[model samples]
Target: MEAFTTHTGRAVPLRRSNVDTDQIIPAHWLKKVTRDGFEDGLFEAWRKDEEFILNRPERQGATVLVAGPDFGTGSSREHAVWALQNYGFKTVISSRFADIFRGNSLKNGLLTVVLPQRTVDALWELTEADPTVEITVDLVARKVTAPGVEADFELDENARWRLLEGLDDISITLRHEEDIAAYEAKRPSFKPRTLTV
Candidate 1:
């Protein structure tokens, strides 16, 4: 997981509510155990529509996703977060989010910002009117800001620290590697044994 601090980029506005994990990344994509390359499967069904925002060339390389209420609201698949990260979205702004999905996103260093519905609607409208609109997510200040709007958001302190440090679960565990090694070395009853006793 890459560390997330302040990110400013073109925003990808997904103006729909109740976006479930299955809709973000369908179940068939879960067959691969590896975490790389889920971007292809991200919103696979939605892409078939040809008019989906993700298909718009102007939105390419957008690092922020401005979405509607109750985003990421489905099965507890962490792949939804993976898909977003692989697809290069560093931050997601919404009116609300599913608890489990939010947690998973934080664990993977994907920033999920919950702003009031009014703020979200404003962003959606701006992005819709102009594809060049960009938003900045300042994690250090816990704020999201656009040309004519600014709002405060909240995140868990520990999650914020983990993202700032780009520390995943394994990285956290490795921080205590020396202590673990010493504990194993001190285990009792480790003498060599003879074939016959």
Candidate 2:
């Protein structure tokens, strides 16, 4: 996973509440075994509508997503996070997020910023008025800022550390490799085996 220190880019405003995982990436897209290529499936159903915000030419290449309340509220699908990341979104800003989806996003190095409804509304308006407006997310400072707008967002300390360090679960475990090896060497042979083999 790529480290998220600071990101500044145009934001795609998705002003719809209760955006479930299925809407972010349709269930049919989950058939793939690998994480790559899910970008084509991100918001597959919504993209069908030529009028959708994502289909707008001005919103093309947006790396930040400014969404409404209750974003990512639905089934526990990490693929939803994968789809967003693959689609070039490094951060998703919303007033609220489902617990499972937030966790998945953080684990995958996707920054999910929770701001007040008023702050989110202002961002949406700003983006709508000018698609070129750049939104900056500063993970080190725990802040999101845009033209004439700035707000602080909350993130778990551990998650923030992980992202800043670019450390995935495996990477974090590997940091303790030497200690694990030492512990294993001291283990008694009488200990029950975890695997039948």
Candidate 3:
């Protein structure tokens, strides 16, 4: 996963609530073996509608998503995060998010920010009013900054560290290379061997 320190870009305001994994990337798209190419599936159903916010030309390259409350409120699926990232969203801001979806997003280096409903609404208004408006999300400062908006967000230190260092689960386990090598050397010859670093 790519490291996330800070990001500044335009945002696409999505006012609909209860956007689930399937809506983010329909289940049909999950049949693919690789993570790439899901960009086309991001909001596949909604994209079919000519009036969808994402379909607007001005918001084409937006890297931030300002969504309604209860964003990502359905089943656990990492693909949702992938689709968003593939579709060019580096950060997501909302009043609330499903625990599983938030976890999936963070682990994949997609920052999920939670703020008060009032603050989120303000952001939505700002972006919707001006598609060229830029919003900055600073992970190190745990703050989001934009014109007339400055809000702090919280993220556990460990997750923050992982994102800063670009460490995934496998990368984390590999950090103990020497320790794993030492333990494996002392294991009983009769025991089955596990993969080593």
Candidate 4:
């Protein structure tokens, strides 16, 4: 996970609501064992329509997603987060997010910003009108900023710290590597070891 302090980029506005995980990345795409190739599968169904927001030439290369309410509100698949990240989205802005989806996104270093419905609407409008508009998500300041818009958001301090430090679950565990090693050294030879020498 890369440390996230602040990110400023153009956004892709997904106007539809209730965008579930399957729509983000269909179940068929989950067969892959690695994360990199999922980008091709991100919104695979939606990409079929040239009229889809994501298919618009102006929205190409957007790094942020300003989506409607109830975004990521279905199955608890981490692959959804992987698809977003793989598709070059660094942050996702919505009025609401499913608990599991939000958790998965944060763990994978994808910033999920929850804002009021009106605020999210404004962002969608702004991005839609001008695809070049740059929206900045500042984790350090806990706010989202764009031209004529600034909204404060709330995230627990621990989650904020983890993002700032680029510490995923594995990274957090590795921080106590020395302590773990010491404990393992003291274990009886007959005791079963979870990690091989």
Candidate 5:
């Protein structure tokens, strides 16, 4: 997983609520275990519609997604996060998110921002009014800011630190590899003698 620190980029405003995992990448796309190339499946169903937010060229390569409430609900597939990353979304801002989805997203280095409904609506409106509008997510400060809005938020200290350093769970554990090796070296290795019966 790539580390996340501060990201600033064009915003893609998705006003729909209750976007589930299946809608994110669909079940068929799950056949592949590798995380690469799932961008084709990101919002597969919605992308079919000519008017979907993602279909607009202005939103292409957008790194920040301003979405509605209850985002990433329904299923617990980590693929949802994978699809978002593959589709070039680095940060997701919404009024709320499913706990499991949020955890999965963080584990994959996708920053999920939880803000008040009013603030979310404001951002949605602002971005909609201007397709080129940009937003910034500052992990260190735990804040999301735009032209007229600045909202402070919270995240687990450990998660925040991990993202700032671009370290995933495995990378974090590997940081203590030397200590683990030393401990294993100190432990006595013994084989039990077989008892003749």
Candidate 6:
């Protein structure tokens, strides 16, 4: 997973609430084992409508998504976070998010920002009024800001540290590699071995 510090870019305003994992990336897209190429399936169903906010040309290359409440509300699929990241969204801002979805996003380095409904609505309005307007999310400061809008967001301390340091679960464990090696070196010879001959 890539490290996330601060990101500033155009935000796509997606006003629909209760967006589920399946809507973010349909089940068919899940067949692939690799993380790449999921961007084609991001919002697959909605993209067919042509009028969907994501399908709009101006919304292309947007790195931030300002979505409605209850975003990522269904399923525990990590693919939802993969699709969002592959689609170039570094952060998602909403009033509320499913607990599982938020966890998945954080693990994959996709920052999920939760703010009050009023603040979320203001961000949507700002992005809708001018699609080119830039929104900045500062993880270190725990704040999201745009023209005439500034809101504080919450993030777990450990998750914040992981993102700031670009450390995934495995990377975190590897940080103590020297200690793990030393412990293994002192293990009894009769102890069950972890490796095959």
Q: Show where candidate 5 strays beyond 4 Å.
A: 171-197
Per-candidate local distance difference test: 0.90, 0.92, 0.92, 0.92, 0.88, 0.91
For model 3, residues 49-153, the per-residue Cα lDDT tens digits are: 988999999988999999988899888878899999998999999999999999999889999999998999899989888889999999999999999999999
Clash totals for all candidate models: 0, 0, 0, 0, 1, 0
Candidate 4 residue-wise lDDT at 96: 94
lDDT score, residue 85, model 2? Answer: 94
What lDDT does candidate 6 reach at residue 122? 89
Considering TM-score, which of the candidate structures 1 and 4 is the better prediction for this target?
4
The residue-by-residue lDDT of candidate 5 on 1-197, one tens digit each, is 68888999999988888878788889999889897889999999889998898999988878998888889987888888998998899999988998899999998889999999899988988999998888999998889989999999988898888788877687678989999999988877573448744
What candidate 6 gets wrong by more than 4 Å, as runs, is 171-197
How far residue 112's Cα lies from its native spot in candidate 6, in Å, is 0.4
- For all predicted structures, in order, the TM-scores are 0.85, 0.87, 0.87, 0.87, 0.85, 0.86
Question: What's the CA RMSD of model 1 in angstroms?
Answer: 5.5
Q: RMSD for all candidates, in order, please.
A: 5.5, 3.2, 4.0, 4.0, 5.1, 4.0
lDDT of 3 at 162: 93
**Runs in model 2 with CA error above 4 Å?**
174-197
Q: After superposing candidate 1, which stretches have Cα over 4 Å from the reference?
A: 170-197
Model 1, 121: alpha-carbon shift in Å?
0.4
Residues forming the 10-long window of minimal summed lDDT in candidate 1: 188-197
Ten-residue region with minimum lDDT total, candidate 4: 166-175
Residue 143 lDDT in candidate 3: 98
Question: What tens digits encode model 2's per-residue C-alpha lDDT throughout 97-178?
Answer: 9999999998888999999999998999999999999999999999998989989888888889999998879867998999
